[model samples]
Target: MRTAYSVETVRAAERELIARLPEGALMQRAAAGLAAVCAGLLRKVYGARVVLLVGPGDNGGDALYAGARLARRGAGVTAVAMDPERIHEGGLRALLAAGGRLADGVPARADLVLDGLVGIGGRGGLRPAAAALVERIPAGAVVVAVDLPSGVDADTGEVAGAAVRADVTVTFGAYKPGLLIDPGASRAGAVRLVDIGLSLPEPEVEALQDAEVGALLPVPTASSDKYRRGVVGVVAGSAQYPGAAVLAVSGALRGGAGAVRYVGPAVDAVLARYPETLIGRGRVQAWVIGPGLGTGRAAEVAEVLADPVPVLVDADGLRGLDPAVLRGRPAPTLLTPHAGEAAALLGVSREEVEAARLTSVRALAAKYGAVALLKGSTTLVSAAGGPVRVNPTGTPWLATAGSGDVLSGLTGSLLAAGLDAVDAASVGAYLHGLAARRAASGAPLLAQHIAESLPEAWRQHP
Candidate 1:
């Protein structure tokens, strides 16, 4: 699994490592790694033009030292200093000795631009000068950010103002929460971690890798029967949106559930698509409620909640949800809500929820006493108190309708298969996102396509 640390923890780790190493040794290690990546990106360092946007901190020093290395290799490297007085003395001297020159402004043309404008310590967004310089970067340039993109919160992934949009970001030590979550994740187009040998504690957030997912997936044994595998009950869809039932059932069928007992008004539509569906309520290991069951399905929701089985609530089911109903439940429960739904549940605007996704999801989980999955640019799963699981695999194409219903069904099946609410939600989101990426392949795709692609995704993971 790929893990992410909070800014405070990362800073402490870096400090501890720095203290253990010789003076300037840690910086040299960072610079060496940075320079190596730059060399690789440049292909032939000789005669290549590289621009370094140097700020007034250690990040700038790292870039300056890297520029010195590139200069020695015969590259025409220019360091655009954001603050001349505060430049690293050692780094500046090295660059000058290696024939690198300081420039007032960026050159007209350059193959690469290293954004060392701000480090993890930076707050809010880019300062005026930095933001102006970032805007001047040529479109063709491959912008590689140092540590992380400038103007992003290393801890929260929040971007208050203008930020560097890098083609790739080479981070040191370990991953930060910002690098895995968005809008910082999006700003950091592609992230590569450079080892700086800092021993750290448990991460603040985590993304499960394929190996972990494969191990967690419920596999059948030779002696296992249909009942033993697990049964998932889906209470979703309404007359208004019969397609939701079809899609939810579509996902449940592929969700490793031994049998799917669907109870809703869209029974005919679901049966037409998945003929093997058990048609009505039965003894199920878990229940997935509220996906297009428009209002008026309160009785169905109550019945599912009354049962001792694990339950997943989503979409229309989240509307006017009573937190009291979910308090101190015997069985585990998961709530899947998109930004709009989450905003309504929290009595806040969608923008507020989007701005603080981690907090909102955690708050929802605590308030309702269930695992909450906030679905958006970054699908986050949070329980009452623990590190949020940030899903890594996804595509913008998943914005299509009916996607949540499919995810609800998928996660509910995992819950039935004996995984807890946290694991169930996280794994389901990962596979669901992976399926969308596979199905879309950069083109428009319907929600059904994602459901259809789940088997391929499941097999690929295992």
Candidate 2:
């Protein structure tokens, strides 16, 4: 699992380590790690044109010390400090001694630009001076940020103002929550964690790695029969939109479910593509309700919720969701909602939910007392009183019709296969996104293509 800590946790860990180490030892360690990453990013360190954008505080000091290291190695390094008088004296002296000079203006073009303008302490947007310099950066110049991209909220992943967009971010000590969630995540192109020995407790957020997901995946043994593997029940699709049934069934078919029992009005539509589907409902371990069941299916929704099985409520089922009913379920309940559906459930605008995705996801989970997967640019799965799961794999091509329906089926199958609510949601989102990326390649792909690519996705497990 890829775990990320909040700014508060990171600071506490840093404080503990700094108190035990010699004066300036911790900063040096961070600077060294930062320099190593910078050196690797540059094709050849020697003669490389490196420009450091310096701000006040320890962030500027890190860049200055790192700049000094590169300058001593025969690279052309310059430090453009936003506040010259406030720069770290030790770091400034080190840079000057190593042949690095303070520049009056930004360089026209450089091999790389180190953004140390803002750190985790920064609140909103970039300062005018820093923003102006960032605007002039050459298009092709590789931008490497120290710790995190300037202007991003380290805790909330919110970009309130103009932020530096980095090609690669060399974060010190631990991963910040901002680095794992969007729109801050989008600004941080690629993240590299540099260990400085800051001991941290449980992370604020986590993204499952392939190895961890592989361990959680259920693979049957010789003793396992079809019934033993697990059976998933899908109740979806309306007469008006029978294709939803086909797409949902397609995803369930690929998921590791032993048998799929579907109950809906689109029986002919589902059977045409998936002949093996058992029509109507029998005993099931879990149920997926509403892909295109649409409105006016209150009784159907009620019937599924009454069953003592892990349930995934999605699409139309999420429209009139009552927290009381969900809390009453004997088994775990998973709620999958796109931004719009989530917004509806919370009685908020879609834009509001999108802007504060982290808060929105957590709120949804707490309110419903269930595992909530908020699907969007970044798929977030949150359980009540727990850190949200950030799905690392996905493509923009996944925003297609019936995509969520496919995800519902896949996740329902996992639930039936004995995964918990959180695991089923996170793992399902990860696989769903990966399959879409594989199916799309570089061009457009239909929702069916994503379903078709699941076996290939499973093959890609590390």
Candidate 2, residues 157-222, lDDT tens digits: the string is: 888878999999999998998998999999998899989998989888999989987887778889
Question: What's model 2's TM-score?
Answer: 0.98
Q: Estimate the lDDT of model 2.
A: 0.91
Each candidate: RMSD: 1.2, 1.2
For all predicted structures, in order, the TM-scores are: 0.98, 0.98
| Global lDDT of each candidate | 0.90, 0.91
**lDDT by residue for model 1 (306-332), tens:** 999899998888777788888857998
